[model samples]
Target chain A: MQEKIKVTINKKPIEVEQGTTIYKAAKELNIHIPVLCYMNLKDMGIEHNPGGCRMCIVEVEGARNLPPSCVTKCTDGMEIRTNTPRVLNARKTVMELILSDHPFDCLICAKSGTCDLQKMAQDLGIREIPYQGEQSTYREDTSPAIIREIDKCINCRRCETMCNDIQTVGALSGIYRGFEAVVAPAFEQNLEHSPCTYCGQCVAVCPTGALTEVDQTNSVLGALADPRKTVVVQTAPAVRAALGEEFGMKAGTLVTGKMTSALRELGFDYVFDTDFAADLTIMEEGTELLDRLGKHLKGDKDVKLPILTSCCPGWVSFFEHHFPEMKDIPSTARSPQQMFGAIAKNYFAEKIKVKREDMVVVSVMPCVAKKYERSRKEFSVNGDPDVNYSITTRELAHLIKQANIDFHTLDDQDFDQPLGESTGASVIFGTTGGVIEAATRTAYELHTGKKLDKVDFKQLRGMEGIREATVDMDGTQVRIGIAHGLGHARQLLEDIKKGKSQFHAIEIMACPGGCIGGGGQPLHHGNSQILIDRQKALYKEDAGKAIRKSHENPFIQTLYKEYLGEPCGERSHELLHTHYFDRKKRWIKK
Target chain B: MSSVKVELHQKDVDKIKAIAKEHHNEPEELINVLHATQEFFGYLPAEVQEIVGEEMNVSAAKVFGVVTFYSFFTMTPMGRYPISICTGTACYVRGAETVLDEFKRQLNVEVGVTTEDGKFSINCLRCVGACGLAPVVMVGDKTYGRVSPDGVKDIIDEYKDAE
Candidate 1:
């Protein structure tokens, strides 16, 4: 048994665990303490993440002055007051000061009704600014995953925490002092020039309109209007699970058929499924994994064990920034976004006998990083890149709204044949531990020359940051680990570096909960972790699909037999696989 | 070394020398050495931390975290007359910020920073209750009374030429 600390807040005595933060203790007592920099009930540690934002201040009766409740620990017999007039007045003044430097145009802002700062001001009954000053003038960064409007920042430090502490990317931070303070890359460079993975974790955590996904609706509408281009749209496997929520549906409601119909109503020439490319990815990636395993068994000294899955663009970019040396360990298979883009430009263009340049491939993804992934030069095939424009699931909702399309009344429509057809293995690609589970089913059968007793690896599923499991297949016991979020990724890599991890394969996702809970996903009531209802809905989708395994997808089998011949063929390496260069070598070596 | 002079502690100077020794005699070791020194002290004095960070290829922000996170570090030299103004919530509502403004005007230096003429380093604490004393500003570990805007000049003049 441990000693309990007794603290009195607003005349009510409360007993809490030793070292419990004042903010957390207040929550346990049902005390409403307003916070900007604090997110509670999260699985991660809480030291206010970065403590740069001075928003969580509270008064203690016997103490000398107000302390930030998030950082301050409770002591035995401490007297605290949360709703005192003095604390209330101080908080109001600070909020006023923060808003003074912010932009005044909330009506036109993309974050109009959902911003936390706006909600807090409304709660405090603050309608007008008390002071006037020169707000920092900065042009919007407007990148793939995120848009930077520094003028809207209250310096709540949520973006910084999300980027550095949560994602462990260290791409954004506060530079300079006093009035010159701004969060940005070193020297305030453009995000395109930096090693940002475009995970959009920062955008999701932003309290105001300071950070948001770039609006590509204008470009999409322009392409739709253009007579010269034939616009085709493809949505990823995980997108349907959350798309229904924008129109009063539950978080995990499966809206796949409805979403397809809605796209058709919007005048898209073809509504393809990214799951087609996802199944295609499994074929290419699965083959590559087996080749590497074979090389390792043959005692190839250069063979890489635990070849990390490279399906997630955020994880791929993380490799470029941090572990460039381990780049070869990543499967050469381009993500589903690139796979669809390449085929649309190369194979599909040639088949339809249309000029590749005239075909526009639009990707609707749950990931903001996919937007950035589309812009990279490596994703291009010959003179044309695979993906033309990428939009988040939220942006897709915005598009439907822009067109005045009633999503609820939309009729169910099927995806275009051949490329649109996919398996349950591809459908589960949106959830965490999905890729490993999908690959294991096929790998075990191939290795042992027998069928698997269980298709679902229930042990490996869910949203835990890091999960490990081993299965006995034939004479070989396959060891595997799944890690979500970059902070957990760092731990796994460090463990690997220390020779503590002995695994045949490992799966790493730079963002939490894989693509379904991507940084670009819809923000729901401040609890950004993939809601339980949504996760259940995605698995339900997988359970209902006729074809559960990627290997069993007949279309993928036909694709290999007709065109590619083999997985690691010369043509496969030319198109599907890519290489990486070490960016941090000089920095680490020096 | 030149007319633009800054004074530093002997212990700080010795620690900087030791850091430089580990990084080889390469001149770029200056910034890294200065950051390590600032970790021991409170802040980097003038060219100290900048010189060390540039030498190590580590940016100044990395060096800044060392100074800022650790309560002891300072970028500017400590005031020959150090003044800590308490402008926390209780005092701020009681006009402690106004008192702090007077000190800044009198000493010609902002909070958490120092004056150029070897005179004062002004910093504001989160809180130092003496709410009855309301708006208080401490000068060199000694607490001052309800410091008003009118008393700013007198407080500085007393410390003038004392060093």
Candidate 2:
């Protein structure tokens, strides 16, 4: 067991584990110290405490100068004064210096209400910036999913840590020094030119307006207002699990009914669920998995055994850039978002007696990368995209507020028929290990020719970065692997590259905790417990459903019977399955 | 945003690979390897750093970061006759700012930039360990002590005439 040490903060004594940060010890005493450069995702095992901003400086007795509490370790009998006049003045001066270089455009900034630096300035009561000087400025970089307004960076290095340490994308790093210092790609290249996967993890961790999601809400509103256009909206499974937090609802609050009502209020002609498409995904992907498994079992030497899940656009981009050699190893099933768009524009539009061009299929996702994914040329035909617009969970919340809908009192409603109906298997796609588990449910039943007594695969579910489990499929021992976060996915891919992996199928979600902790979800503000709660809400939603298997979803059964014909058939491949490309040579700009 | 792009020669790529191999391609020895590359090539360019990144298994952005963090490394090529003006506190007090301004006026270039003609470039150093020679300017290896605004033209003319 770890040793515990006693420390005094503002005259109150507390016991904490040795090597604990002074900030943690002070929190035990109910003393809140404002911090800017410190971010701790304890559950994800990611902590960035650069102590660059000096906003969390506290006076340690017997020390010559105040030390940053976020990075400073506590010793036994250490008396720390967080609110001393000396510490207060120093913090105020440091904040003033930071503000002096920062743009005073919070009224127009995208991150005004949620910016950590703005809140820190308010907490410090900084009325004026006394240390005005030349401020650092850089040209704005607008990518498909994110915007880099680097002039507002406070050099907190939070985005750097997330990009390099957590995601391992390495598209961003701290460059230059002193006043010229900023986070950017090599040669200050634009993100599109860099190896950025457009995961939006950097935007998720940025403490200021330096990084943010590219706002597509205005275009969505324009489409909604168009009289000739029929704008149909689809909400991803993860959006409902966390959208309630944008209002005053608690973290785990399930707002599916209220969300559908709010979308209807926003003038969407029809409100559908991406979970419906997720069910279709399982039908197609599960069949593909079974075919590959059977072929490998028949000693097909050329067959790749462990077929990877390709539902995440960010993960797809990552593999395209980093592991192009294994491009053919993942399943060809299009993501649920794209699958929904294709079906809405083709099948659903035909049923509604509307031309595909006159119909606009918008998606509300808990992922920023979906914006980039929907914009891919492969997903478009003759310049008409399958999905017209992709907005994030945060953007949807903003649209609801802009529409003046009283979300709290909105009546519980249901999704539109056919395209809106989904099963419990589809609802679980919002969290890690969910897609593979959902696939296993159908695959097990289909492969063994027997019904599963319990649909839930508890062994495959957890918060670990990488998990492996063996399932008894009748008599065959089929191994499965689950990985979330691109860094963890890199390890599994490396194992596959070395030909040492022992799994028959693998699932990879680019974001930590899967879509529940997506880059476009409601900001947790450095509290990871919100992610756990969101995961719980998704599981609860799944448990309460009457139909628990994708094959068991009646609407899906009707659709496959009426339209798709059979899973992975020729028509299904045309509409649902897609191909991958080698993007390793794309980043070398001349 | 104006980004600087450089085309590397095959020899330069080979040299970078050699330097990386000297450091055994360890990511932790990135700084040392970068120093050796800068020492051989006079400055670190984007293409050179990209090769080093690939060889050392580090990111090009991180290699650029280390290059820009230290004062000794330069991204652009230095002019044949590089002019460095001391901007130390002692030198600034002794009218070094005026000397720097005069150099900027004559060269038609800002600090850390080369002239369009490629004959001269201007830079500012904190100190050259010659506090006694306050307000000093160095042209290549030769130091000019007590340089005034009037002498700036003479320094440029000396290099221009020599070429």
Candidate 3:
């Protein structure tokens, strides 16, 4: 065991483990030392305390000057004062200095209320800026998923850590120095020009308006306002698990019924569940996994083992940029969001006797990458997009508030029929290891032609970055691997590239906790416990369902019988499945 | 998804690969590899950085970040006669700003930018341990000490005649 140390903060002695940061020690004493750049999501092992922002500095006794408490380790009998007059003066001055260089457009800023800097300024009671200077400015960059407003960047480097250290995408880093320093792509290029995966993890970690999701709410509103448009909305499985946090409801409060009612009240002609499409994804993806497994078992040497799941658009972009050689290794199944869009336009539109152009399909997702995924040209037909637009969970919350809807007291309502019904397997898609578990549920029974004694794959579930399990498929051992963050996915991909992988199937989600911890989910503000709560809520929803298997869902069975004909059939291949591209060598000049 | 594609010759690419190999292709050797590559190529361009990233197993954005962080590195090529004015506190107090402004007026080039003719470029540097020289300017390796705003025209003329 490590040695223990005692530290005095505000004359209250507290014992902590050796090498404990002063900020953490103060927390034990319930002394809140406000921090800006310091973020600690201990559960995910992601801590970004650079001590660059001097906001968390405290007065250490006998020290020449105040030192940053977040990085400074505690020593025995060290006396620290966090709210001394000297410290407060220094902090206020530092805030003013930061504000001097920052744009004073808080009222009009996108992150006005939720901005950390704004909250810090208010908390410190900073009234005026005594130190005024020329504010730095840069051209705003708007990509399909995120917006880069460098002028609002405070140089905290949180996004830098998330982009390079966690996601391993390496699209953003600290460039230049001093007052001119800003996190940007190489050559100060636009994110679209860089190898950015559009994961939006950077946006999720950004404390200010420097990064934000591309607002498509206005266009969605425009579509709703159009008389010629029949706006149909699809809510992702992850959305319902966490959307309640925006309305002052507890995190992980399952608000599925209220969310559906709100969408219907928001003028959406039809409110469907993306979970329904998730069931369809399992049917198609599970069959593909079994087909590949069968081929490999028959000694088909050319067949790729460990068929990777292709549901995450961020993960797809990651491999397209970094591991283009393994592009063909991932299953060709489209994500549930895209599948729902394709079906809604081609199948559902025809069923309703409405032209595809007149049917506007909007998806409320827990991911920003879904916005980019829907924009891919392959998902379109003759200049018309399969999905009209993708809005984030935050955007949906804003829309609900804009419409003056009281979300908390609304009566629970069911989703519109035909495209609304889903199974327990689909609800679990919100959490890590869920897609593979759901796939295994169907593939195991299909492969062995035996009934599953218990549908739950207990071994295939957890929050680990990378997890492996071997299932006994009759007499065969079917190995399965699950990875949730892209960085973890990279390790698995590297092993596969080196022919070191032994698994037959793998599931990868770009976010840290599957879609529950997605980039476009309600801001958890680095509190990982919220993610755990969201994951628990999804499992609870799953357990409460009557049907636990995707193949057993009557609606999914009806979809196959009436329209798709069969899983991985010719029509399904055209709409539900898609191909991958080697984008490593493709560099477009602006 | 637009970017300016940077292309390099095969020989230069091979040289970069060799430098990376010399550093054992370790990601931690990124800065050292960049310095060596920059020493050979004069400046670290985007394409050269990309090649170094490929060799060193580091991201080009990260490499660019390190290259841009230190003021010693340059992305654009230096001119034939790179003019540097010391803008240290001592020099600035001694009217080095006026001298810098004169150079900009005469060369028609901003700091860190090369002239249209590619013969002259201007940049500001910290003190070169010549506090006695107060306001100093360097053309290539030749230092001109105690330079006044009036002497700015003479300095440019001297370099022009030499070229």
Leading candidate by DockQ: 3
What's the distance in Å from true for residue A139, model 3?
A: 1.4
**All candidates: CA RMSD in angstroms?**
9.0, 3.2, 3.0
Among incorrect, acceptable, medium and high, the docking class of model 1 is incorrect
Sort order, lDDT high to low:
2, 3, 1
Task: Write out the backbone clash pairs for model 3.
Answer: none
Model 3 residue A30 lDDT?
Answer: 93
CA displacement after TM-score superposition, residue A414 of candidate 3 (Å): 1.2
lDDT of 1 by residue, A1-590 (tens): 88998998878899998989888898888998888767642654524434445567889977787888888899998888888888888889888888888888989998987789888888888888888978776667877668899888877777777776777776676755576666776435577655577888888778889888877878888888888888889998778989998888878889999999989888888889999888878777877788788788889988888778888888888888777767787787888888888777776777677788888889998888888889887787575668888989989999998889999988888999667888888888888888888888777777778987678888879778899998666777778899988889878887777778788788887777777777767885456444566778778988898888888888778867877678768766776777765654132111
Interface RMSD of each: 9.5, 3.6, 5.1
lDDT, model 1, position B152: 79
Model 3 regions more than 4 Å off: A585-590, B1-6, B81-110, B122-163
Error of 1 at B151 (Å): 34
lDDT of 2 by residue, A53-91 (tens): 898999988999899999999999999999989999999
Which regions in candidate 1 have their CA more than 4 angstroms from the true location?
A7-13, A46-67, A75-81, A84-87, A138-144, A498-500, A524-529, A585-590, B1-32, B36-163
